[model samples]
Target chain A: MLAGLARQGVELPSACQAGACHTCLLRAESGDPGEDGRRGLKPTLAASGYFLACQARPVTDLRAAVAGPDVITPARVERRWWLGPRVLAVRVRPRQPVEFRPGQHVTLHRGNGIIRVYSIANRPGQARRDGLEFHVRVYPGGQMSEWLAGAAPGTGVGLGVPAGHCFYLPGQPAAPLLLAGTGTGIAPLLAIAADARAAGHRGPVTLLHGAAEPARLYLGEHTPPGLAGAGIRWRACVQSRGEDIAEAAADELAAQPDPAAARAYLCGGRGSVTRTKRALFLGGMSLASINADEFAPAAAS
Target chain B: MVMTSDPRPLYDRLGGKPAVDAATEIFYRKVLADPVLSPYFDGVDMERQVAKQAAFLTMALGGPNHYTGKDLRAAHAHLPGIGDEHVDMVIGHLAQTLRELGVAEPDIKAAGAVATSVRDEVLGR
Candidate 1:
């Protein structure tokens, strides 16, 4: 029966068939046990009727549902560029339109079968065409970076859309907005700002961008020139300079009125994002109003 | 001298910093020409990112620990939400890059496994 399923081209999630990885563990709604102990469900998970389809043969008819979305489509590599020696602006677009909150990311498939994830840099409505965009910084010898450097136009890449929980929730439009980004992570904040502007939001939008040096900043050209005129004020901080970008952003936030009623979004290198979020929270901004996304380096393969 | 079956050091397998740097440069060029991802990188600085990536890789691949940089998660915390699909695409590009560099098949697979391990962390899952 497993052969039949495979012959019919039924794909299932699986890793480490010995059940060590648990990638194929699935909940069985209703089914009777088959004789083969090879049926990969652990005793504890099996008591709850969780079984591995890879190990379980379909006998006496079975019913099951996947925990997550069944179909995994590759994201398209829409563009790429070097923001600095280590920062890569890898813009990705999915084949389908994915709906997500302001701060979130998707997983991308390098041609070599490695998976690297990046945050969505554009908002739902800001794509101007189709699919969302993601900005990625390539760490040397990193899987995604290597593939991107050598890929040509019209390459097929895999992508899992709209993952991650951090995002801006809609609330009273009058709340002040505090936005921050470091390196390629700035992509999402820019998207949110653009979305807010397109929606004609009148709230004050302050964007604080930081980098190790002025040369490392990405997406400066794509930043809408009218952002300031649209009531969105942006300030850039070079952290290698005497004053760090987070410090400048905090100072700018302090000068604003009623900061307690503001919503803060911070993105960038892990340290910068953490520092900025802590500063905002200590400055009286409610914890619930602050959203953060961390851009971790892809571990060595 | 006979080549040993034991794995070569990552630096040797990657052909040193210069080879990695070349690969990085090629990756950005591909990204810029792509129809879907191009708009995001328009007007971005490519030279600086290439240099930083070389340094980061040198450390990651066990050559030298010269990467004095910010943590990854904090840097991307402010981005628009990324989904599973986007992650797959990024991974695909990475795999292609290894192939371009003439990396051994086993090494490529090992590299891919490493990238896959961190999917949840990078995607904020």
Candidate 2:
């Protein structure tokens, strides 16, 4: 596809032609792009005909153009609360309802071209006018985090289209779900667990949240009543107290007596996400069954 | 042997993208289960790899060659520690996966030949 386009005098910006770098993203204005071309793009982008030029072998004639600037939805801060010393829970109300799943992320656009991606921490349409929820990790002097920490209700912000493939997927109600995260990464896992239960997931759902210490674990004291009722078990793993969260979570998963297939969702810092994924995969989880969302360092932010 | 000059691309004969997708699901499972190969893929997201593999396999089996020869060499050169043994093992897995999917012996051999044709570039030799 890339070659054909170049031959016809069309040049697409690209790097890592293997599709690792999404630099060659193009929008199909007319025809269907292969799923492989849209593989890791946000569901919303895929649905709207965005695809990777490097990966797509177009079966149908596609009228494609370079992806334009992201569409930004205006939003307002509705509420803010501290999840822990370092984690701030934020709720924002978009001007209109933003279609997003439980665990996908959106880029919060501050003025001056500054934007940061955050996972949506609540399921859409669950609470009236709740809008979107985000668990922002407050880094001292961090531009976006500091602003969000002090932002008042009605403070305006811009939201990029909901993006990312890490989200609660319906179907397979009986499949066991194992979720693990560290720090504010638990935000998405909470919503995913709730989404699963609400969808009538019957198999055991276990969530393990890891933090440096007990005091840093915000949800340790309170498991949402709705989640508790949904039979989702939540465990807090603290590293300061000698608990290796990844290993502990992997052990619990390996102990499951049933041979039923299980899916594991992991989030958090890149290192921890990679570590947990390796542990889970090594402990008999298939590579395809493990999903992860690694919080990239604020290089772009 | 009868299909040697069948005029149809091996990709079409082995079935199209859907067939490649099915073969990849089985192939990667075998690769990841192999102790020697699994280590190379540790901590990698298999879902994305599966998609990329499907595309690559489709090209290898005589589908649209989206990757330029240079792109192909660069892709393989970036993988650390990939050697002749690893390459052979990967091809073995692909062959086995096709066999499991009931692909004909001749078609499987043709696929193997196609894969081997690019072995030097794949190994960055």
Candidate 3:
């Protein structure tokens, strides 16, 4: 549905287009989203006419649009910081407060319609009321990366509403949690850990973040507040010369304690996520219990 | 005989790759733990087997048939003691996995029917 709409010049911003991330869920004003489309959705949400566009084949002609699709909140870049040689941090304050869960993602559509999906690094509820933050890996000629690397404060950008499935829900509040990420993938993980702590979760959270070198372990510089205070254990894995992210992730998975009841969230490149999910499953973790968000490069529609 | 519009493929109605992948992993675990079926997978590379099974099930369920692995009869030819009983147990475990995942009864029966349709080839009969 999204692709067809895109072909007709109505571009929809999407990432992890496999329906793993709810990046393209839209409201079907008057149609039935087929059976598979209703899987994993709450009965209430199903009744509310929400459908994942990637999987929805409408049984009837439908009026579909992103939730409040007409509203494109404009945000201005307020700050930029380099987390590593190639990774940059961007902070933007929306014209209005954008409500989103800590681990959700937002798509930024440039004037030319180049839409890029970025994971929001700010925790919801109590992070900052004024703005959104993201960690971006600068690709030399990448349009969004180039613009983001040096976009001055006050430069305007459009922020799409946030959507994702990997956010921290207060499930089994004390459920053992496992989080793993690589490079900028740690952005969402950082927020999730904060949210867990803010929610006063008493479970053990084992966070394993990997970078190619010590310097690239961006979030390791200063432990975010409450990470240690809330008893969340964090480890940084580095491969100074060449980062074998999957290997580092497997090493992390190997050390998880009693993973049976743990709800795990893994983020990183698709290859790493796939390998890690496989390893975790073979290591006695249920595949259903492991939620993953693979940071696939947002493709041009 | 006339053909009608292609009916909704079973794979889509039951959920696509993600759903099938989840079911395969859980089902494979059960198959490996079953005393009768566990022996058949003793020295097999389970990771690859799990993926192949998922692809097979996806194709069998009327999704894009990307399974290019061994034909069922050829694949099971050399296994010791492979028979209808083993096939039944494997399919039973799969049905149970989908059940555990909260798949609706109709879809579960549809999936079981797909497995039954393949009995001859899987059992090399």
Q: Give lDDT per model, in order.
A: 0.60, 0.77, 0.73
lDDT of 2 by residue, A1-301 (tens): 8768889986655534555335466899898878779887767778878888889998987898765555567889999999778789899888867887788777786665556778888888753367798999998888889999999999999876676667767777788899998988888898888888888888888999889888988877456665777788777889988987788778878877652378888988877887787677656666667888877755432
**Candidates sorted by DockQ, best first:** 2, 3, 1
Q: A275 in model 3: Cα distance from truth in Å?
A: 0.9
Chain A TM value for model 1: 0.71
State interface RMSD in Å for all models. 16.2, 3.7, 6.3
Mind giving the per-residue lDDT tens digits that candidate 1 earns over A1-301?
3335557986554432432223344555676535342243335445656555556665676676643333346556676667556666565566666556656666566543365666777676665364566666665665667668666655777665444545665665777888888887777787777666666666788887777776766545233563656777877777666657667766877887777788888777667876676566546564557777666554334
lDDT winner among the candidates? 2
Which is the winner by lDDT between candidate 1 and candidate 2?
2
Measured with C-alpha atoms, the lDDT of residue A203 in candidate 1 is 78
Clashing pairs in 3: none
Task: Candidate 1: list runs displaced more than 4 Å.
Answer: A1-69, A82-86, A111-113, A128-130, A220-229, B1-125
Docking class of 2: incorrect
Evaluate residue A272 in candidate 1 and report its C-alpha lDDT on the 0 to 100 scale: 80
Clashes of each: 99, 0, 0
